[model samples]
Target: MRSVSRRSLLRGGALGVAAVTVAGCAEQEPRQAQRLAAEPPDPETMLIRQLIAGKERTVALYSSADSDRLTPFRQRHEAHLAELRRRLPRESGSASPASSAGAQADPSASPSGAATAGSQISVRDLRDMERKAAALRPRQLDGVSPALAQLIASIGACEAAHALALSRSL
Candidate 1:
């Protein structure tokens, strides 16, 4: 007859926990989010990729730390990436972003945060971005497709929320 001792059971439970921890770490693809795929020469595609990279980094940071406070903000960032990519021109869908007047002239843009300008944004920084997005609306809506206006408005609202969340988190 086999006897199950208390110490043996405790050791088995500990082993189970260790196995789960190792499995969790093994399943993580930490660098996949940083790998922006090479696409054709499309500014819109490049911009979308930039947005995705930024959002993914933020999400990863929050996820690794198990922070629930950032859930909504991370979701909004993901939405902006998905929505903007869906609305971009197909030809420019795979191209790299261009640093020219043509790309600059795009009134319809995404919220990429202060990271785009080579700095980290504070709570106030997010609020400023929201305000800027709202101001852009009047001019951006001028003679453009209704779709564009709606998209910008959606992003504006989300950006505002991000500002509020940042303030609370900080």
Candidate 2:
């Protein structure tokens, strides 16, 4: 084995540190890119995007329902989604509500296990989801445009009405 000088040891140690630092930075770059790609640029637009996503998920839920009454309700969500998409800024790219909403519209997207396998969703579950969604609208109003705020309120009212209708159906 060759004798190792102190300078050589120091150089190897520095190179190892440099290599680790570079590797760490390289790993972080992709994660940063992914985060930027996944997150909406503005909070207001993010809120609208979330609402559109929720409506799409709701539509998916209603679509999977066995009842004829749910069909009109599902259609209403589709109309809401269309209107929401129309309100989204053109600068939003393909990140517009329509595309993003569809991407997240799976029934499994619901947090409450409301759309489980082999089991039909209960009317109570629908009511609960609508009620929760409607409750979220007031909180979403502060940072949005007046027209968007009005639309959110209207949609919340509609969801509240849906909750009542679902309650009656149960």
Best by TM-score: 2
Give a tens-digit lDDT track for model 1, residues 125-165. 44444455455545544544677667756766766566565
lDDT of each: 0.51, 0.75
Q: By TM-score, how accurate is candidate 2?
A: 0.67
After superposition, the stretches of candidate 2 with alpha carbons farther than 4 Å from their true spots are 1-40, 95-98, 101-119
Q: What's model 2's overall lDDT? A: 0.75
> Looking at model 2, which ten-residue stretch has the lowest summed lDDT?
102-111
On lDDT, the candidate that comes out on top is 2
TM-score of every candidate: 0.43, 0.67
lDDT of 2 by residue, 32-73 (tens): 889878875586666667767777677767766778978877
**Lowest lDDT block of 10, candidate 1:** 99-108
